[model samples]
Target: MLINVPENVVPDALRGFAAVHTDLTVDVERRVIVRRGAPYDGQVGLVSGGGSGHEPLHGGFVGRGMLTAACPGEVFTSPVPDQMVRAAAAVDSGAGVLFIVKNYTGDVLNFDMAAELAEDEGVQVAKVLVNDDVAVTDSLYTAGRRGTGATLFVEKLAGAAADEGAPLDRVAGIARRVNEASRSFGVALSACSTPAKGGPTFDLPEGELELGVGIHGEPGRERRAMMTSGEIADVSVDAVVDDLQPDAPVLLLVNGMGATPLLELYGFAAEVHRAMGARKVSVARTLVGNYVTSLDMAGASVTICQADEELLRLWDAPVSTPALRWGC
Candidate 1:
């Protein structure tokens, strides 16, 4: 409800975000953000993009051992092919580029167009479409599952592979594997108000919540009466676990949907952990914070990625990004 501006919010916010990171370079003209000295010359490049408001996703992820560049569009709007083309070119190190595309129709079409354009420019390009959200099989904006938290997994795992000098195809394959093994479900306590919309995207009356909501503030599978935190935790974890059908150790990511406070996130994470234990699910790794977010939406999502020895090794690899930094 309280953004700095009523228009041009994305560019204005990007200026501030770029100013804070010395390792990042913002190409205002192209609306592309890249990590300094990325692509590492001969290493396969990783590039991804989507609507703007999901901060710290594609943007914060641009750094060593992660993404080479990220293209951000206006809030909830997909970046154009030109933006992706430029970003891919900047990060291509003679080793080709891999575009980590979310399954949203706009994102898929734009990234596909960019890939073709880049190929014409003599750059080898590959794509891995992410559709790991278990919220809905089809939505108003997408034909399949809406990509959600698993986009982070795909970027990190695939980026680590690329940073290790894996070829474009291999990196894309890793991204696909991560997506196939991950599932996510979200619950929204309140709707988000975008600067452009100037009001809540959707209305959630008091004493009610939307279960299995999308990150773009889209209506979820169903609406339910608001329950206790522990009860909400049960529902969220149950949905993901049922869909994932994990047979091995798991990586649990409890993510906040932007405006939720840290205090509440941590509390919710604890409840989720307990729920997993009751189900005899083994959680080998855990991340609790706001990673993939829907701007200022007061809700949380639980993402469970089936992790094996190989996935665990990649997950533990060093990564340094603005929103997530570790093993560096």
Candidate 2:
């Protein structure tokens, strides 16, 4: 809404982002954001990307102990294969590169093509798909479950492995393991407006909410009247916990969908914790905030990853990224 022109939104934002994030090399022409000291010798490269509007996701996660490079697409649209090829090439060290792709049709297809292109260029590449959203078996944008909050978990844990000089196979293994262990569910309190549309993408009447909503404002499982934070948490947590059926302590991500205030998110988090307790699920680590977001969508999603000792350790490893950083 504050943008000068809808057409230049992505490029204009990239310019400002480049100016602010001096540690990253934001190639505006290529639309690839890579760490300054990329191709870290023997370390396997980590690359992930998706549509824009979800700030601090692929782009903001590009830094030490996280993504080596990220390719950003236009709002709610997948990046082309060229961007992925360039990102893989830019970050590929002697070790192979790992592509952490979300399970969207456009993303999967584009990343698949990019892997082939990168490999043809002598950059060995592997890929792991993130499909942790448990709301539906399939969605408008995906053949399978849509990738959601677990993307941050996969990027963080897998990035740590890569930072520790893990081989391409091992890094990919960690990513796959994380994905297999995670589940997410979202609720939408309001619809988001896109720059291109300049209006609400979907119609949501006042005092109603969409349960099990997708991040891109897609139709969800059901619509219901407005519920209290505790009631919403009960439903969201039940969805994830029932699907996950965790045997071990879990890593919890109570993520905001862009427009929700921290005040509401924290309160909702309290209810989520309570719900988990009621379900007899132990939470090992809790992260609450707007990590993965839908543009100005006032809602939240709950992501639960059953954490093993290794996963917890990798999570605790030092990370220095714009969006998520600790122990650095």
Candidate 3:
């Protein structure tokens, strides 16, 4: 069974979501919002997003130590310039705004236009495109890579630094560090429905799984026989840790794609913890749940953050927002 709606439905939902955060958001084009008053002088405003199905992502990450605004797109479509321009204006303080965009064609183009618009308005605009999906080969079709789970880690960590009053350059540097050290790979047990498509975006015949699937319905590296939760966790975490070789203590996240339940996520987290200890790697802390996701993709992704002293401190800092709030 498939369930897709009109393409514009997601935009409508975004508009309504923004209305609730009137003090923190604005649905100017009906799909975006700025989080607060103009960023403090010498403070950098952060912006991020991609498609809509991955809710509680870009938007949920808005607030202290997260994002200043989030521009959402239709189901899986990238948001256009109109949305980005409005968000940029609302958040631009004296310093500048950092666009934390995932590596996707429409997202890059639209955000680029917004940057031009902001620069014309005499605001400094810097952009960091995240492409941490190691599953995607560095090749044609895309502008080199794809951004996956790293988007969340970068947003929260970078926002943490910015909240500490770091300059745009320094905050951007921290974001880059997070990106360079993190990698993600996902698998889909079942396909998700798209509003525009009105049905399951992809199909998995019953027990087969697609490994390394992209968040936006792209085909993954390979499909394989199914395995238990612990084995799945072992394989995915191995891919991430092997790529990073993060000698320092690291932050571990075992995340549900969207439809996956917390019970499964907890089981996945336990396996991740066991595997890391076996590798002699230090776990600074662990965050488990659906922090970043693909519509209803029934899968999980693992992200490892090799944190330096400063970064760990930032991660520990308090953050208040619709999705994540702690250390209050």
Candidate 4:
């Protein structure tokens, strides 16, 4: 089957999604630029966004403990600085705002521009660029590699730091540490995220998988014959474990790309857990969900971060975001 989704339609529908969430509200004319009131006095606010296709991300993360505002753009496209500028202004309390941007080129460029624009308005701005996906490590084509599942970890941790009245630089520094210590690896079975692009993002007949897959349906690092779910989990997670140190305990994120259902995600997580135990690794905290995704890719990824004391503390703090809320 084939489908061609209209450009403006999805963004329009997302406006309603924004309205329904108490922690978020959409600026219809601006697409999914949802706002959440700041949580404290004189506390630096967090504002983050990118394209809307990766839902419950920048927008879903808006709340008292997370982002104050999110500037969502069209599907798979970066938001303009103007939208971010608007969000920055709205969410700015007396302190400042920190922008959590993925390391993609368009995202990096636009967010950096927005920070500069916000500075001109006398808003103290800091940024933490996330690039934890080990899939595409080359910096030649894109700006290094794409930011993947670990963003959720960064968001919650940073939000916690901000909630406790940490300065912009300190919050951003912790976010950077999360991004640095973490690593992700994934495998894709089928793809179809954009509603218009109905069928799989790419044509993958039965008995094949793309390893090291990306969120935008881009090519992966390896294409191989299909394997069992347990094997798939082992292979994907092994790549991440290989890069991590043996002594450190990790904060784990087992994420379904999108189309992968919870039934399968649970099984995958179990496999990843089993694999870690076999290596005598300890898990400090864990998250499993559709964190960063293509429209609907039938796959899952494993993210492992060797957590430090500060990072773990921040992760345990209160957060009140739309997609995730706890503690406070």
Candidate that scores best on TM-score: 2
Q: Which candidate is the best by lDDT?
A: 2
lDDT of each: 0.89, 0.93, 0.81, 0.79
CA lDDT of 132 in candidate 4? 78
How good is model 1 by TM-score?
0.97
Cα RMSD (Å) between model 1 and the true structure? 1.6
Candidate 3 RMSD to the correct structure = 2.1
lDDT value, residue 14 of candidate 3: 64
Ranking by TM-score: 2, 1, 3, 4
lDDT of 3: 0.81
State, as a TM-score between 0 and 1, how close model 4 is to the true structure: 0.93
Q: Name the regions of candidate 3 deviating beyond 4 angstroms.
A: 1-5, 19-23, 140-142
lDDT of 1 by residue, 1-328 (tens): 5567767687877888778988998887679998898657789988999998887788999987889999999898899999999988898889999999998999999999999999999889999988878878555655888899999989988988887888888888888999999999999999988888788998899889999898897878899998877998898888888888899989889999998998999999999999999878899999999999999999999998998898899899999989778899
Question: What are the clashing pairs of model 3?
Answer: 4-198, 5-195
> How high is the lDDT of residue 200 in model 1?
92
lDDT, candidate 3, 4-79, per-residue tens: 3475566566666766766565664557766766565667889886788887788888888789988887777888
Winner on TM-score between 2 and 3 is 2
Tens digit of per-residue lDDT, candidate 4, span 300-325: 88998888788888788787766777
lDDT of 1 at 89: 86
lDDT of 1 at 94: 91
